[model samples]
Target: MYDHRKLGRELNLFDTDPLIGAGLPYWLPDGALIRHILEEYIRSVERQAGYRHVYSPVLGKRELYEISGHWSHYSDDMFPPMDLGNEQVVLRPSLCPHHAVMYRSRSHSYRELPLRMAELGGMYRSELSGVLGGLTRVRAIHLNDAHIFCTLDQVADEAQAALEMIRRAYEALGITPTRYRLSLPGPGGKYVADAEKWQRSTALLTDVLERFGLAFEAAEGEAAFYGPKIDVQVTDGAGRESTLSTIQVDFHQPEQFDLHYIGADGAKHRPVMVHRSIIGSVERAVAHLIEQHGGAFPAWLAPTQLAILPISDAELPNAAALARRCAELGLRAEIISAERGSLGARIREVRQVPYQAVIGAKEAADHYVSLRLRDGRRLDPQPDGDVLARIRAFVDAHGTALWDNAARHCPERKS
Candidate 1:
């Protein structure tokens, strides 16, 4: 089992310090780049699916959670409200109420049945210190979260659409959920006591899952206080199950917040809200990816796609120039300056770098670069333009690894 925490330290990805308080892990440049890529990728998918992203403040007034009922049921899991002279506020533990406010910002007609709003936003939760071990469990979390407000009749279809988006992301990342859980409110529990609404929401989620042909187990007392949810469980390399994605159907929130849309009959009707998170937390997902590939990321997601190594000081200019050109072409490239260690030793230091380009006196004069993939496969000197093109093509394809023949084939040798 590859421990992500250990790998995180080794790769200089992220670290926690008491100066900033526990559970608040700060990202290093390399890890920050990886997170930026994840966010951009998910954002592109959301845009294509008609989900408009929004930004909201981390602090919300005390009344916000009270209106959403989080204050009644989950206040212990949230930060203590701060007294600000005139108003009390706390870091938002979830975006639900704020999103509800957005929906209430204007009146809508049934024709605008489904309104999908998304955010890659931060939230703070108060978790016990014992559970705050790594990126997976922390006080600060960010999610690829969204909320869709639609008519009652559109409930099943909208939830299904959200699931499809989740599937697209899971497929692209090569992460598969091993188990599906349909979490429902248990009898006489912390959940809202709306029997009719619970049954209706649970039924809607179940029907959507059935339509999507997903097998799931029903877990009692596993639901959010306001609604039932579909939780996705992925078993990690260590054989431990972790929940990284979820789709929740909430009928209670709209009612509590007095959210309504005008119906076709000109009467007001409450819209069903479907809440979802594709990658539960950007930080945790990066940690998962670190373990998945053992720190050697695929070309598309690797921070430094190609590292340039010069044989000596004489070739530094050529190496730097090649890196600069690659960067201009939108490929992440970095130059490893001439150093005291053997070229091999220096390359080993950044072994996780997807590709390394070595420029020697001859190669520099000829405007060529010798490519060495992370898997140790070496290729003959090729024109600088050819190398960059190959890299760009691989990234365009979202290559799962550096190359199909990164470890075996010599491009110069025929099959």
Candidate 2:
């Protein structure tokens, strides 16, 4: 079985320290690069879809969660509040309350109804040490969270769009959902007191699922404290299932925060909140990706996209020039010196790198590079410009294939 915990350490992706406490793993450089790429990709996708990014403090006043009902419904998983002079604050467990406060900061009209706000924000959970395992169950999380404040009639459409967004993200990231789950409130749970709100929220999510023709199983006791949600479930290499994406319809927060927008009739009306996440948490997403691809990530997502290997010390100058060119194209390239080992040994060392450009004596003299792909395919020596452009194109397209005949249109002849 391919466990991320094993691959993560072997690849130097991340590590945990006793001094930092359990359930909190610090990301190494390569792992941080992968995370940064994913974050940038998500932000661009959300921006094109009209989400306004925002930043909120990681700590919130204790009363904030109380008003959002989290304190009453989900405090067992939260850290104890810290005493700060005349007031108390705690690390936020979720971002919805802070967003609700942002919406209430100013009055709005029907035109701005469906205002989408997004954040790659930080939050904390008080998880037991026994339950903590690698990135899958971390105390500190950076969530790809967003909320859409829309009219009651717009909830269904907004939810459908969110689901589609999640699907697109899954395709690009090479993630396959195990199943769709309609998470609902169950008996003996700390659910919101409003039965009517729960019923309405559940119905909204059900309708959305049915309209999408999605086969979903309604799972009880899995709903968030405030509302029911559509959970996109995926299994890891060990066959352990977990939720990676979610879409939820909430009515309680607007009421608790007293959020309103003037309608076309010029009267106050409560806006329904649609909560969604394309990638639930950066840590979990990376963990799954690690197991899914077995540490061989796609070109764009690969930490070191290209490794420049010099066959001998004579080619170091040429290799350095090629590296500079790659940097100019916004590609992450590293030069592995000949002093490390033999050329063959060096190639094996960076087998995880998607592309390797070998600058040998003859190739350096001709100002060309022999391209080596991770899949063991080698292309004949080509000019530096030609090779770099091809790499850039594949990375930009987020392509899975290292060498696509149609997209790249290079000759099949090998070195």
Candidate 3:
């Protein structure tokens, strides 16, 4: 089994300390780089998809979740409230309520229907020690969460689009869903009391799934507290199945928050809330990614995209120059000097790097670099401009191949 906990430690990606508590791990330098790249990629995708990003505080007033119904149904999973003078605040377990409040802050017109708001925000969960492990089950989570406020009529299309976005993101991230699940509230579960709202939300999700021709199972009791959702499930190396992405059509929150938009008919109408997460939580996503690739991430997501190796002291200057050029071209390049070890040893050490640019005495004299790919393929020495251009192209395209000839087209790149 490819366990992220083991691989993460081996690669110096992330770690947990007793003082910081279990369930809360801090990303090492390399891990933080990967996370930053993933975040920027998600933000770019969301921006192109018409989502306006926002930053919301991690703590919310206790009354906020109470109004959103999390206090009534999900308080067990939430941290205890902090008494701040007369007001009490709690670390939010979810981002929807904060987003709902943001929506209600101002009135909206029909033209602004389907206002998509996104945030890569932090939230906390109070998990029992036994249930917490690595990044999968954590106390602090930075979720890739978003909410779309659309009219009731636009619910199906908005949901379908969100599912398509998730598919594209998964393809780019190299994630394969074990199955799609239509998660419904199980009997006796802590769900909203409105049966009609539940039925309506479930039907909308079902219609979207059917229209997309995706085979899914209706699983009772797997839903969010307020609504049913289409869950994209993935299995870890330990054979534990969990949802990595979701799209939920929620009519409950808008009503609870008294959210409204003026319709063309000059009447204030309630807008439905469409909650979507392309990547549910950054920690878990990166954990799965670490295991999926066994820490050899794709070029775009790799902590160090290119490793410039100098065969001897004579080639160190050339290696440094090449590294600087790579940096200017937006590649994360590290120069592994000959002082570290022999060329073979350094090559073995940086095997996870996507591209290895070797600067030997002969190549340095010729102003060329011999390319060694992570897959162990070597190419003839190429000029500096040619090497950097090819590497930049691959990284920019976010493709899965070391070279264009073997590249798999990423759907997200097309968008």
Candidate 4:
């Protein structure tokens, strides 16, 4: 029964002002901080897994989509053309074509067969206004987008490695959903123009999944226009299911884009293409996070990790100094000026922030801070560094701003 709109408003995450067109989100400072944390999380995971960060254009020439078959299958979702001097440009619907352009920038040898490129690419899509819902569905969104180019022989290991990274991501986000799906696009629906290639690619993916012991359901016609995909789905709190991650197999795109790699055989070979988003789209994931956690974020992901409340104006400076120390240790902290309201009212406000540090004149004078845990465990007065260390340890263990006292608070599951 957690209303996302109300929570979003109260938390200052984002809003849809009537003045701004619908489905276009304007993230407030708090929301932007969360976005940075998410992006950094993905980037850190990707880099450790050998992905090179890349930047691709927000729009591309019409020829790019025409080559990739998006112009025919998904043109309606694209923003209308922009006349760029002599060329007609359309906003990129996906990151594959641009990634292909990156591949073609240089001739890669067999040693570089599995070149992984990742981007936090912002994209624009003209969605029907009626279908938009907060961050879950939006016209403009950014993706945790990535593309992998691997030799046909190397596809399985590459795919499995991608899955490992995704698993780490799920753990980091504190999501544990028992049911997972590997969606193979329904053939003959969108991008399977070559029957022989489709059959081989699909079979190759199936074998890869079997060899990896990964279970999946074949989704006939669900494949992207350029390839077949394995979609990762998680059921939300209300028994509604949605995609959380995806790994797509593409053979046609290499041929369509004339991509090539020098193989061990010393000849040109078309490397298989894998498009993956471990966390899917950020907007969609954050929306799902709100739903999954019922708006109670874990410590690591909480926008405001530690809210400080001083008993009176005399203690504000001390609380502010402690908050600064918290920030230096990579924790987000804010101090409520004591004059804003009564100490009890302040504590109520502190609960809304998930974690709070209460400062009284005695505690401030003693150079110790009182911690009010989310689950009602209050530590009387402790050293500032010790309190900060405990908070960091809790956040580190939970990966997000989640309370570690699970015996007290029941953490949500995706289903």
TM-score of each: 0.93, 0.96, 0.96, 0.91
- Model 1: worst 10 consecutive residues (lDDT sum): 406-415
Backbone clashes counted, model 1: 0
Q: Model 2 Cα RMSD, Å?
A: 1.9
Better of 3 and 4 by TM-score: 3
lDDT of 4 by residue, 275-323 (tens): 8899988888877777667766777888888888888888988987998
Off by over 4 Å in 4: 187-189, 211-214, 396-415
Q: Which wins on TM-score, candidate 1 or candidate 4?
A: 1
lDDT of each: 0.87, 0.93, 0.91, 0.79
lDDT of 4: 0.79
What pairs collide in candidate 2?
none
Backbone clash total for model 4 is 15
User: What is the C-alpha lDDT profile of model 3 across 1-415, one tens digit per residue?
Assistant: 7999989999999999999998999999999988999999999989999999998999999999999999999999999999999999999999999999999998899999889999999999999999999889999999999999999899999899889888888888888999999999988859998999999999899999999999999999989999999999999888989999999989888999999999999999999999999988999999999888889998989999999998899998998899889878888999999889988999999999999999887788878888889998887677767889888988888657778544322122111
